[model samples]
Target chain A: MSDPAAVPPLLDARNIACQRGGRMIFAGVTLTIGAGQSLLVRGPNGAGKSSLLRVLGGLIPCLHGTIDRHAPIALADEHLALDPDNRLEQALAFWARMDGVDRERLDFALHHFRLRELADIPVRMLSTGQRKRAILARTMASGARLWLLDEPGNGLDAASLRGLGDAMAAHLAAGGGIIAASHFDLSHQFGTVVELDRR
Target chain B: MTRWFLPLVRRDLRLAWQGGGLWMPVVFLLLVASLYPFAVGPDARLLAATGGGMLWIAALLAALLPVERLIAPDRDSGIFDQLLMRGISDEMIALVKLIAHWLGFGPPLMLALLPAAALLKLDGAAIMRLELGLLIGTPALAALGVLTASLVAGLRGAGALAGLLILPLAVPILIFGAGSLHPGSGAALKFLSAISLLLVAITPIAAGAALRAGRE
Candidate 1:
């Protein structure tokens, strides 16, 4: 087995700052996560946790920071991101194709999220927790090395929440990393936690 | 990167077709062209003289029909963020969407123009000129539509605002395209082509910037 220390961190961010509409969000934030690890970001509403995730995902520009990403990333924010008109399986498959992942992985992700039976349903018909599961399935199917989740536990049931913990543990065991933002407790304990204060 | 181009275009085309986005504008164009005769009391010479210009105007308005559908839904649904996360640049997304938007409306509008021209009593020569002008001009109209859609994508009342934004930017193309049908206006065709090419070239970059700005 390769020395875990020798593998560079999956994400290396330093002095990261973000702002919106010319207002400062947060500044002087720094964190790093290596393979087989996870980081949890905790904060109240409007504390910029989602914006920070967006910055880390490169979806939005950071006002001041240097970030080095060593692997591909997947994000599951509040946005469902699935095509409303497409069947669940097809919608997930579209992203799988985009990520260069194969059919087997998509099937595995569907089963992983307990969405196999719901695969034929149109995405628009999915209830809130089911939609959240679909988003997580999309992230899982992406085969990316890092996962960025925003409010991942919002609508999950007790059993599904436990399944989420199992999935995170399995991902970490497989050398994938996670950065999730949520005030509620998830199944797995993160290696590190950073709490953001409202500015 | 190149591999994604066709699939994205195909997806967009499918959506446009399924959503009735492809045919609505064609129907709108035909309806407007057919109405011109009733409003003007069909004198053959008058129809022939004004028909080409009326079609150009109708085509411009038709381009506006699907503006609200172009980027707003995808933006609202986080499709843009997902694509961006996959390392697809915003410019590529805009370009693909521009191509798809054109494919959806431009050809159908031209085909619709055939019957519309017949309704307007245009001669064979005039019909050919109108078709040629539209072939050159419709791409610019599509680009303008995509650009405006990107600019106003997340705003309330985006459809009305998109129409307002696209019309003024489209004046040059309209003037040149409509003027090309005038007798001995070969230079007008060249000007139309130039402006069309310019809009197509810049739309992806401009719309891409608009999308990134919208994130903030």
Candidate 2:
């Protein structure tokens, strides 16, 4: 792994607090991850893991503190964030085109995720694992420098999990970073781990 | 850009065509118009007299039915989030969605009115008037529907709420749409045209504001 001090931090979260439904999920949480580094955030169910991911992705309003990023970020939540009625290729192409990524990169990303065969299928027909793979493909195709993945390993088989690990490693090698929140044992793949207690 | 609009519109049109649910509005329009003759008996004059109003009411209701589903699929699949994050201005997003909704729901409802008009024994002039009025009025209904769709996009029972919110706003369109069918009613046509223009002008602003607010 590259030296943390040598690279600027891609994400800086200082004293971040998030509350939902009058319950405090987490408070006074400070964390930072730098370029070419990965931070795995582990927490139990209903512990605001997804909430934190949303806040980081700029989807949900943060209740307190600051989150600074040095590069553009891509977020992949469990919901897949894709139009179900749309063909897989069209949906990914739309997002990729909108994000200014080249078509070649998009095709490569889809093929890498083993989704080239299913590209023409409507998203509603895809199995959970396939849908997750498609979401990952879109995220990879985004070409963002920082990735905030809620559950990168969810619904993936052993081979796909390894493929995901390889993708993350490749992204890091290219001066990109990942902030993955997963319950699985990803310590071997990720450079660092940050575990949170249930509130 | 054609790149954005064409693909989006084409995709939506295909979905609307294949979904089967999109035809419900057309069915409702015909059903509602068919009821007019039955309720008032087989008097040709009575049907003629009430045909315009019946058609307009049916058209309005038809336009209202399928609007809730316009944004529901996107919201459910999380595509709305991706759209918001695409860096397109909220106004443009609202406009694109409005266009899609209009093409999917509005155009078909207008087409469905033709058969209904024939069944109501509307003469050529009345049929022409209804068509013209629908052409102008449907766009406005679509704009309003888009605003309502966005407002209720995240709510339960959004279909009911969409109807409730849109029907009241549609009163002017209804009046004008019906009035246009009267022979020698230039003033009504002019009024309808003016209202249509006003709605077209104001709809973008309302839709844009609502989308921006919702995103924020």
What range of 10 consecutive residues in model 2 chain A has the weakest lDDT sum? A183-192
Tens digits of per-residue lDDT for model 2, B107-200 = 7887887899888998888888888888888887778777788777767888998888988988988887787777788788788888877876
- Writing each residue's lDDT as its tens digit, candidate 1 over A1-199 gives 3786777898999999998988999999999988898999999998999999999999899988899899999999999988899999988888888888889998998998899999899999999999999999889888899999899899999988887888888899999999999977677799999999999
lDDT of 2 by residue, A21-123 (tens): 6788888878888778888888887777888877776666678999886778888887676667778998788788668779999999998899999989997
Candidate 1 residue A55 Cα shift, in angstroms, is 0.4
- By DockQ, who's the top model here? 1
Per-residue lDDT of B29-135 in model 1, one digit per residue for the tens? Answer: 88998899999988989998998998999999999888998999999999999999999988999999999999999999999988999999999888888899999
Span of ten consecutive residues with least summed lDDT in model 2 chain B: B81-90
* Candidate 1 accuracy as lDDT: 0.92
Best by TM-score: 1
Candidate 1 TM-score over all chains jointly: 0.98
Quote the positional error of residue B66 for candidate 2 in Å. 0.9
In Å, residue B103's CA in model 2 sits off its true spot by 1.5
Best by lDDT: 1
